[model samples]
Target: MNRKELFEKKPRIKINDKVSYCPTSAAMELIGGKWKSVILTHLIEDKKRYNELRKEIPGITERTLSLQLKQLETDGLVIRKVFTKKPPLKVEYSLTDFGQTLTPILTSIIEWGLRAAETKGEFLLDE
Candidate 1:
């Protein structure tokens, strides 16, 4: 089927009552996009500028990265700082304290992914 038809055919989840979005769902809504996790992972290190992030994450479009960064900022997971300088100005991104709380969770996921990759021989295929 064509893209539109395929999407139209898919079933959508709906809540019958006036239920509010749960914390878990809200969290997912913030970070569940394609680039948020990678962005957060990079921010776990030292603060980085926009260009630095683009270089590190291959295949991400500038527009997508910008949108993800904005979302993270809105969620209070990332702080964006702009410097007023002559010649060339710079923008930097860093994790807020709320965002830092995600470090252990992301680290655990990374560790589990590493173990799973080893067991499944996934790394060998990448070589």
Candidate 2:
């Protein structure tokens, strides 16, 4: 790429008080984590209850899930809703408009995973 193109492609910017020379770093700050992206992948489909998220993500522990959810919420990427006013409370999680912006990135990641599983790695069945 030419110097002018490089300059156009990567302009320094700041978000959430962090300065990033490259935009990818900014994106990673918000979504780069072991479980953050996975949780987001599920949320891309639709809103899910807390238990539902826990169930869908097999290896994630309850505490970890809770923590990740809180972080995502704090980052303005996820929203939580409580429906029930009494016992057997109902809560659901969904992507915010900002979170929805990640749909394409997440989709690309999903596609890459599938391709790698087929071409380079093997998918194993759960015991």
Candidate 3:
């Protein structure tokens, strides 16, 4: 369908108290922030401690990472596990079953990013 017709006929869907005209947009809203998908991509391999995530995601501040993780957990996409009941607490973050469903999608984004960098720009890992 043409762009105008598509937007005109499709009814909006609502979930989690957010209204969205497109499902993709709604999906984006959930994983829309700068670090959410990156965080998810990292967690795809295995659960990680909060500090491990901080080290892997360069440039992300402690506040932002913590906020993103909390949001993800609230959305039922991530689980936070605490293994200690006292000082020197140990915590780990892992994806929920629903979050695992995002594997292909996140992988596709990662692959596309590589393709874009190689074709249009360049990889600066050595620099």
Most accurate candidate by lDDT: 3
Poorest 10 consecutive residues of model 3 by lDDT?
A: 6-15
- Cα-based lDDT for every prediction: 0.83, 0.93, 0.94
Model 3 CA deviation exceeding 4 Å by range: 1-9
CA error at residue 11 for candidate 2, angstroms: 4.6
Q: Which regions of candidate 1 fall more than 4 Å away from where they truly are?
A: 1-23, 124-127
Per-residue error at 124 for model 2, in Å?
0.9
Candidate 2 stretches with Cα past 4 Å from truth are 1-11
**lDDT at 97 for candidate 1?**
95
Backbone steric clashes in candidate 1, count = 0
Better candidate number, 1 or 3, judged by TM-score: 3
User: Alpha carbon lDDT of residue 60, candidate 3?
Assistant: 100
Of the pair 1 and 2, which is ahead by TM-score?
Answer: 2
Backbone clashes per model, in order? 0, 0, 0
Evaluate residue 101 in candidate 1 and report its C-alpha lDDT on the 0 to 100 scale: 94
Q: List the lowest-lDDT window of 10 residues for candidate 1.
A: 11-20
Deviation in Å, model 2, residue 28 alpha carbon: 0.3
